[model samples]
Target: MRHFIARGAGLLALVALAGTASAETVLGTPLAPPALNADVTGAVAKHFTDAGGLVFKDLKPSKARGGKGYCGKVATAADAPFVPFQVILEAGAAPSVLLLSDADGASPAISEENATLLLKNAGCLE
Candidate 1:
């Protein structure tokens, strides 16, 4: 009886851990701080190759369905119009960048599907 109870307790512990693990974000439980300058510049360069004069601003720690990372805005200049952006940086994983809007009603920098997913994960959408 004692041995059976011990085994049952072990099984219960394992089940509990599994449940919590499934709730954790696959992108990374607690994402790492992004190399703001380098990462943001690289994202801009990659996503908006022909664009220029863009600057990153209002960066702050953010936690969302996607994971924990940084959220901020990109603007053409200090006082220029801006668009929202979310960057998810994780060790050993490629960085994820979501350029939400063009700030001029233009199409997004990335594909529609990707933009939507990022927006949802970033809690911008329900």
Candidate 2:
């Protein structure tokens, strides 16, 4: 009984932590930091040729041209010893950029993903 009660309390704490964590944001709102992408199929295929990630391109709401948002895609490594992953970095509706990166080396691997996710959670995916 005691053990079960302790586990339940721990789970509750974890839930609380998750709820608070999702609220953190780097950029303010609407406006996002910046990203890269590939607007064409050829470009998307060539994306991340360097490391193993993609880039975002062609942003929306062209304040200069008109419209709004961003969009894009990602490609995981084809070889082994590397966990294939994807990165869709967008400023608004589409990913503004994409690039190839280490699958699971260290912080760098998930660094951008973390940042992007943060911005998304903060509603900064503009």
Best-matching candidate per TM-score: 1
lDDT of 2 at 75: 32
Per-residue lDDT over 14-37 for candidate 2, one digit per residue giving the tens place of the 0 to 100 score: 111111111211211222333322
**Taking the tens digit of each residue's C-alpha lDDT, what string does model 1 give over 32-77?**
3334445534544445533455556555554543343566666656
Alpha carbon deviation, residue 53, candidate 2 (Å): 15
TM-score of each: 0.47, 0.23
- Backbone Cα, N, C clashes tallied per candidate: 0, 41
Give the poorly placed runs of model 1, Cα more than 4 Å off: 1-36, 65-68, 102-126
lDDT of each: 0.45, 0.28
> Top model by lDDT, which number?
1
